[model samples]
Target: MGRYNFKLPDVGEGSAEAELVGWQVEPGDTIVEDQPVVEVMTDKASVEIPSPAAGTVVSVVGAPGEMLAVGSVVLVLEVDGPGNAGDEAAPSVVQPQPETPPAAEPPAGTERTGAPAGEGNYVFKLPDVGEGSAEAELVGWQVEPGDTIVEDQPVVEVMTDKASVEIPSPATGTVVWVKGAPGEMLAVGSDILILQVAGPGNMTAAPVSSEGPSEAPSPAAVAPARATVVPAETPERRAASPATKPGFATRTPGEKPVASPAVRRRAWEHGVQLQFVPGSGPGGRITQDDLDAYVESGGALGTGAPTGRQPKTGTEDVKVIGLRRTIAKRMQDAKRRIPHFSYVEEVDVTDLEALRVTLNAQYAKDRGKLTLLPFLAKAMVRTLPDYPQINARFHDDDGFVRRYDGVHLGIATQTPTGLVVPVVHHAEALTLWECGAEVARLAAAAREGKASRDELSGSTITITSLGALGGLATTPVINYPEVAIVGVNKMIERPVVRGGQIVVRKIMNLSSSFDHRVVDGWDAAEFVQRIRALLETPATLFVED
Candidate 1:
């Protein structure tokens, strides 16, 4: 046997370094030549580095999220013969270190057999997101049972009330058990997965009778039970109910009540103390029905207390997941964090409309039909030079504001999934036709769920419109981190006095919101007025500054 050092090849045009996104193989894993071994992300694209020779992976260099330069030794492997590493190179003999001790190989028959049932298994619990949420819905799992996982790799994506985040694995091991299905809510501190790690793991429990944890308790033991109400008018009648009476048990005077986190949260919300509630679940555990029965028996009723009402028909519970959940979180964060100040201005676009119609008539075949949005985009690009602060991002946590010289415009588009803001990058460099084309392309890509991650992010400012569905005026929410958002309202022909005479003209309203922490009221108003002036004149939009 011999040792070989594998280096990262140049993945891009003259690229010197790449971010180590993740590893595909760990130590002790066997690989073949030309197999992808590691994934690195460059400025242009994400590339997977392949193994140069078939070997057993001995070790990997650098951790995820760190920069690894090209031509650096990324992996060391053990091969069959005299390898590339010369005799003068490091020895094939193992070196001793104090931090991590080497493990003894298992017996011949038990080489690949996982820790007998539940022994040597680490239960990965759901962690508190610190948003005061007691539970999060399992959106999806990246790995399956029996798949190997590494520390700090994303194993699951969970959606909470505040945001959707990926939960990273805490230990390197093989997945032996997974808890909840997608769309099921899992409580904080509840086991989400069980991993079979080397040596004694973080958890020690009773032996299972089956191959895996199939014989273990159901994951629902940690999930919230569904609430079912039975009609009972009096306390005596409630005590007679089967679910509340049979197998029911209560805690001792000093013993704390046993309940899932979901039930505890419900009790706290209704101002019902668990010390007084009876447990009707297995092993003296309190279920959701127990709480309801307690509340019906004249328990403490706070503002969250349910009022008596007639029973209604069946209702469906739709779990919020995926894109809808993301939109909800971002909208909530924008409203909660930004102190918004809105300014509305009316612009007469009769001249601009006439110019647009003439341009379409003259160049309809050569150029695509131009909409008002492209014109509005051009006008904003022209007007942003005088109001640099409006084209900026506010990093509230970092306590800094980044005002950009380039205009990367976010066009709010409505898709079948949800509302998405597809960006038109470097809008200041594009012509009016080019801006329209780019917006159309991005919107199509976003609606089809085919937009790349780079195409959806990095916007200095945003423009939102509802097209003909737009009302008189709207208070647009500034996209979080961006200082300003421009809202385009419905355009209509109305009778108005023009040059002392009542004349009909095409009019539109520009309703915009600015982050009060970064932009003042006077500057916001002046900014809108400048955009209005450029749009209303229609000629100055083409003039060089």
Candidate 2:
């Protein structure tokens, strides 16, 4: 048996390190080639690194939440035959072997070179992915300037208000320049990036330089064509200042906290403001120990019980990234593009609750139990036909509203990552049981981060519910392009005047919002009332038109 040191591969473009999320396999566990071994997260996404060769895990390195650099050993494996570790280890004794004469040089035009022929500067443009949109918002960059990239490697992600997509590189090369920053809009066919390639490229006709090994000049023999001037370090600059040094307890005012990504993540999770926590590392750099000390000192203001009544001046600025950023941008765009008007209405679900309980008690064994959402979904599916204007996508740019006959319900779900709305396609055709099942499936997929693009988008109208944690009321932002969004608040038993005397009744409020441009106030109210009528009467949900 031979030992293999499995290192973390470069999971993200130009990412030097990744946060170790978890290990799928433990020590002594046998794994096959292509089996997922560890899960890590870069700034962009969480990726599961797979084993390149089958082996039994001998040992594992790094804990969850630790930042591991690319190519660093994360696992030691025992495999059949000689492994990579043996080849990499230093030799104890030198063994002499007979040397052979070098091979003859290749003929002209057949000289073997490392780079591809005709390599040159290639300008990659933003492709039109058939979204019919003229421009797309730059979400984030996967590769940075000066980073070497391969063909088909995702360089950037862009959103066209309809969907988000990763733009891959057309040719492999070194990135010389990038077009735009995140949040900026770039037109289709516009240059996205410029790459420096080996051969004659798509742009410019500079002749390729070809010099033989024997003809190559030494560094001292020839003055360089372009000389790179490096700045000289002065004695004071070379010496570490307290501010720039690592092992220090405090930092200068307004200086950002210096900590490793892992330590920063830990601090964020603990809600310990790094600004208030004095670091013990060089240059006032915060470490894991420092974060632990701050938390133990009861100085963490983000979580746990309050330390004191003293004014908490510590504030941490968190740069939103990935899905959170996408959500923020969509929400901001929704509010800005669509004039929203909110409508709140209360519903009596006493009979509905009784029916739900009875159904769950009866069907919980054979069939899956149902939630209030399925019932609400059934109500909306029935009600939308009466007010087609509410179930539509408004192309504000085109000055038109496209209402659909089929209902694609978007169930707004909150996951460990962030908010995502999984669509329940053809909800109008699905039975109550099927609707409940689909919602459950989609919700699970979303929460697990396994939801596909089809499952995540294409909602004619959306229904967002907080379930038990839902408060009394909430004005939900409309899922843009779709004219309306229905927000379900908490369900509670409260005293209400019924008939003559006050009686305890189960009540829930529907806080819904609509695009005022397409849906009139009366129409929105009427549409919600229709749903209320269907839900309040639960029996009507089964009766078809």
Candidate 3:
């Protein structure tokens, strides 16, 4: 049996490194070709890395939850071929290129030579995949060693923090070498693969070289065609002063710009030259605001005077990371995409509360004791038939709205993992007892992080509550794609006119929001009125279908 060092193949574009989410197979397990062996997660996707050739798992290289660079070795396998009997070492790494200073100006009279059609060796460099993306995880390779590929053929998948992208072959050639295995993170514009082009007769193009001398000039190796001033390393200049050297305004030769990594990332994202962006920092260091102002004003880099913005104090840096990060994105998307109209209506739930208390006294063995939430959910489902817009989803770009026949009620629960909404499917068909039980079950599962993917998604409409901790009103952001959300406020006893007499009534606010794009003010107001009507009469809620 041949020992194969199965490197983790590049899975998708911009994937420099991936978090190993799970493993389908363990060491000593037999696996077949195309069988899923492991699952890796990038910010964009959770992808299953499949086996290329059927083999036995000799070793597993990465642990679950470990972040692995693209092209890193993730497994060792024994292949069936007799030739595989030979021992193979780990995947080879591309030799690091020597850092070169950015030149101020190119030598005059250097003519441009486009892509070569003729034969010879060409080292294909990994091109810049996305803005601000300096490195990416190699997802998988499309061609193997010795495979003949044509120009523009898809070559590999890369995963960036933003998205996954497919890279295409630069020229039609024989694949002689492949670089990096899946899950290995590679820098942009680094040597990734090598190709042997058939030498063309009467060739007009130069052979792309991986090295100097006999090798043809590689375009990637050439510095940017821009005038640059490399600071001279003079004795007088060296001893003169540290501030005199172009440390801030000008970048150090062969060194990265003098800015924080975040500032540098911002510059990259905006396609702004860090050197061109005049720094307003100490000793003229580039700052994030400088880059932002520069890009905002059409490359007017230095014109942005500092606003009265003060640096934050007494603030600890809490990164928006992991599940919390994802929640932020969704909440932001919902608020940004949906034009929400908030409506707060007072509902006298004194009767409803009484009914709940009476029922829970006997509900000791059934539905785990009903609460106001179940009653609210039932009231919503009952009122949805007359006002279906409240129980629907809206796709703005498609201009299509889906009003569901079934109430897949989403219960927004705050958990240790963050705010999670788990769906109770067919909530309309469920009895009051079922709704309460389902809410209890879903809430427990969500809080424990054991809710299934389906349970956490596809919610038609949602209900959020703070229970006893609820305030007078809350304008909750609509859960994305869904048009409405019901927020329950705390019940307060206040003086009210009951039958023309001053009396204390248990009143609560049903603070809710609706997407104005799909739900009109009239429709929204009328819908809440229906809920208020049913909720006020308490008995009407149970009598309705």
Candidate 4:
């Protein structure tokens, strides 16, 4: 028997590692070529790794939940000779080889200089754009199936960890098919679109007079023209440039602008005309900061006015798929397998807000600004010692609870694609400034869809805040394997009794959900109350240490 080692290929774009979500076949199982052998969960999406060569599964290198680096030997297979195994009837599996066609004799109308007559057809596969990005979201399609497309025409828009990028057509041709729909995730090297050239109609149109002397056309006889014939713009190319129509104002001759899709969307939502804004970015590109400054200065469109209208309502039936789908499955599993309890409390943050303003200005340059998240993260780290149960994870098989001494705070951030929680390792050890910087970095990466697999995994506890959503309070679902999660609500001005008279104070709500089987309700409530007290009396956080 011949042994074939099938290592884990680079599944996602630029992904270095992947978590083993599941194994389809175990040792000694007979598997066919192209059969899925394992399911791997990368930061981008969960993908099933198929067998490259047909063989019997000899052994698996790792267990579920263990991370495997790219190119690592995931499994070994023992196979009989090619003809004796399941691959017997399969077509020859040979490595790709480039073929050069035989040179054609000089035609009557053209000279044969050995250069290929027409551009060779190329198959455009999905490209890996981000680290650990396995699949990409099909956001939009510029060229439809069966439409004649030109080379470099934007064929589709795919969302990766970097941003939504437009995949251009490789060669001019009629698009034969599109493999996936909008919002669908396509794996790397997958054939996204197929094209058929308009040139070769049939083999019957050959040389009518093959017997005649193969004489090349005379240079003097060839008519020389000042202008060249440009191919007619196909429908696909026309569709790409919406501003190319008549009467549309063309951009002034200058450097081109650069802005992300999200930034452009935000500009559209604010009803700001981008053409009028004096961009400060490189090459005169409008940036998010420029947009913000324009809005602050009341410079152009919708200045000093309310934002644009709400988006049109539409019922979206999105299948639980991709990273969001995995998150849902894990959450459901956590709720079913682990007993959970929640605790809620309201806190006055009047003094905390004042302190935040002072510290923000004090460390303005080094540490952008001090947000409530870092302060709360610090408070949680300090209060965990009092209620260790809240920091413990339940190990049902062993009938023992696993408690952690240091806090790995998972900060949840929402992106255009879905929700991602990037962990801040050893939160207790980080200073307030360091914690703030980490939070800023992680949140920005999460929002921009650039968080790595390690950054999004292995958290002891989680914190989710929807202060931007303007909700009073919410019980956040606990991110599984970990025992508890804390939620932060909007800070609003409310009437409060100060000594004897009514006073206005800024109050915020805090809520927590814990594994009841591991942590008692009393411990959960006490832990939340401790965090609330720190926020209410901001001085206590600094004084207690």
Candidate 5:
């Protein structure tokens, strides 16, 4: 009999370090070849290292939460037939060595068995998207297996509590396998897709148990035919009633608490400390319900002390993963990369509001309800012919501006999943009624997380509104490649002087943000003035573009 020293292989991101997250097998646990032995988290993604050969686990080198590097022996196994002795293998197990290229293997704790694929397989694990993200819901896949794809092309969209993310391909190859179905949640370092390439590939995927972990990297477990990707508030995050408030769990000003990644994310969002609230789960494990109960009961709320009757429960830790991570990254990028100039124009929409009411009443029977947004969209599209700068896309890396002849306007819609902007292609070609209908359709699709890639992207410009809840005017951020964004503000009635007479008029503000690099202040203001004029003189709405 011989002993084998299984070292940690490269998880693919150039980094040599990974954090030992969990161990699937302990000392003396008999494991099979390719069985997941431990899970490790890298900077880029999380992965589960499988046993290279079937044998009894002699010793687990590192405990959970320990940092391990590539080439370092993570575990030792006594195989029925092997070369090395156990005593000799155990000494060099913890020694660090040069980093190797990461393989496509599952992280320290993940593998493929569910959603069996066709033909050659190359599984790509999901990465640790920083900011404490662990799992994300499978929003959609951009490419199907058997399709040839170039490197860096987007492959899938995953939704997390923080934001929605578009995961790109790691290499240029043919996709041979895909695991999860739509609306399923995958952990940060589990196998997401399999690409068949000419060179090396990840470990082969084998069938796993029907019941295992849905997100966490567990090789023995396989997801069902359709697994539910519950949002943070699903029954999964539930805690004992009236004990703790999940929504109120905040970031305490001390060491991080012992909460799951999901609960940690929830606590971070609410700005409450985990220590302030109590845990209801086993061994001080905090559940989402406990956090919510604490919130309802008014926990410390950043004070580190619950003045309003602190519940004896505990706090949970949820990782900020998936869609939420994507949102945070994109929002940060837009703000940091682009120079924005905000322009606000107050319009006497008294006439425009009247026109809207009349039109809604007229179309109430056949067409759906109409809001000022449709009018605003029509006005922007019509006015774009006069000022083309606002309706454009800029490629910063290429330093080139792409001006589109057609108006593909993006409407930012918020759903329970996250915020998504659905595009209305050729807005200039549509009538106001058509615009309203298209907006409604796109908004519905986005809210349902069913908007196609084309519907979600390719906007020359964007328009945002908070409806009646729009608190005055807002300075909207430019939608990256798009040079400008127009925001619709709340409409309120106040006294105004038109013909030397103080009278009440429906007033609203058009707040616009433009890329100062492309659009000048004079042009920005004039474009908005034109929108205001079109809305005030509703008769101009019939003008052909």
Candidate 6:
């Protein structure tokens, strides 16, 4: 059979290499044209690579976890004909090369003299839609290769460093080929689909060079009556136990044992595992507090034991992968690029808490419990008009701050993976109940990894809360590009003098960070104080003109 060499193709965003994460096919395995062959991880995301021609895999060029330069030979396959003997006759593979303009092809159906207009076949490449600078992982495919797709319909969901975006079909036609599978990374300029159009007199023509074997049968041809199907998640068993293996049971003969990664890491770092510790996590997993308690109880990591030996230092290597890496890059950019400052205040929210409790009892079934966030958001929106500077963003290039009239407040949420801030669009116009409902919806979506790019961006300001975790005060970081962020802490009981009588009262802390270049300290403090006043009085929050 003729050997077809599939070289790593250029994905956009200047990516020249990718890590081979997984392989779907092995040597000697039969593969269909356009079927996924491998999965790759790049700085941007994980992606799948599809077969270029129907063939039997002859050789795999690389091992998983190995970094392969783009345009390199990833795999070699024997197609419909005998293999080429000379190296010159075989497809030469190299690492991925920089993006170049693709060669033009003749319009489809033009081979026939009486072909119908608008019936030409075409191949569509995934476009660079946003400020995306690297390859994107193919998280999912709405349609398989060879499946007919309609214009404007979403065909694939690509996960970039920023967010997942759905790629839409470019035109209505029969899908002739697909070049990648779910979880494979595809470069920005890469060809994602090939389409064939039915022409006049019911004529059809091939899109590729005739020297190659005939194209594989389209999905429509083989399954004409089948309905469109959505893909489902594959099931796999995962480890469910927490017992330690034989070799890692103890530290040294004299060292006390600490269970779980969180406790061990902290104890090892702080040299506190020498004392007795208790576990509180799943399956009695040692938690951070256990290590803290041990340290407070006079524990030490043996007198001279050099603090865990610096992890055998050599090359400081790190892989920029997943959500944590994305957050790091964004935060770094924000700090380096934006001018920031801080403002703080404390609010007496006793009245607001009473109102919330009353409302929850009144609309228990219809609206659930009301949170401080919605009320705070409402107060911020109302105060924005009086201290407009706090609601503005500075444009460094133009030397002006653009003040926004509409309020879009981003709520910072913490998830198992990482922290995400999803926005509540047009918060100023929505009622307290509506704001509460929207906040709940967005927060839930962010926790579930279902927040879209739009939901995560375009915020005029942000609100961050540690909820019960935050004690009396905290200084929150501004979500860059947004000029201000409000930090809400837990409400606690403290002694206060009321009419010369000492009494305990519920009080909360309000800390706000702002872009000092845009908003002055005075204005920022005033804005937070206004919110604090509204919360303390409660009636002011529901005031109508």
Between candidates 1 and 5, the one scoring higher on lDDT is 1
| Every model's TM-score | 0.51, 0.51, 0.51, 0.52, 0.49, 0.48
The per-residue C-alpha lDDT of model 4 at residue 251 equals 44
- Badly placed stretches (over 4 Å) of model 2 are 1-311
RMSD of every prediction: 16.1, 15.0, 14.6, 15.5, 20.6, 21.8
lDDT of 5 by residue, 1-545 (tens): 87788778876535555655567887788888889877665432336677779888777765433456678667777888754664664744432322222665443434544423443335578766433557767655555545788665657655544333445676767765566654567887766765665544555553343664343343223223112322333222222123445554444332223444445445545644455567776445566788788777766232344568766765544444545566778888899888999999898988887878887888867987888888888888789988887899888899998888899999988865357788999998887788889999988777644465567778999999888789887989888989999998899998999899999998999899999989999999889898889999988988664
Judging by lDDT, tell me the better candidate of 3 and 5: 5
- By lDDT, is 2 or 6 better? 2
Which ten residues in a row are the worst by lDDT in model 6?
Answer: 234-243
In model 3, the runs with Cα more than 4 Å from the true position are: 1-18, 21-61, 67-314
Ranking by lDDT: 1, 2, 5, 3, 4, 6
Q: All candidates' lDDT scores?
A: 0.71, 0.70, 0.67, 0.64, 0.68, 0.63
Q: What's the residue-level lDDT of 411 in candidate 6?
A: 96
Task: List, residue by residue over 1-545, the lDDT tens digit for candidate 2.
Answer: 88888888876445666656667888789999999998775533456789988999877776444456687677878899887887563222121111111222222122123334665556677776432568877655655565788775657756543234455677778865565655567887666666667775555432223652232222122223211111112111122222332432254432345554445445544544455678676556566778788667656422343667878665433446445666899899998998999999999999999999999999978789999999998998888888989889998788889999999999999986578888999999998899999999989878765576567779999999998988999999999899999999999999999999999999999999999898999999998898899888999888967
Q: What TM-score does structure 2 among the candidates reach?
A: 0.51
For model 1, the superposed segments whose C-alpha errors exceed 4 Å read 1-183, 186-312
Residue 200 in candidate 2, Cα distance off native in Å: 32
Highest-TM-score candidate: 4
Q: Write the residue-wise lDDT of candidate 6 on 323-416 in tens digits.
A: 6676787789778877777666777777788889999999968976679899999998888888766676666777877788888898999964
Show where candidate 4 strays beyond 4 Å.
1-321, 365-368, 395-400
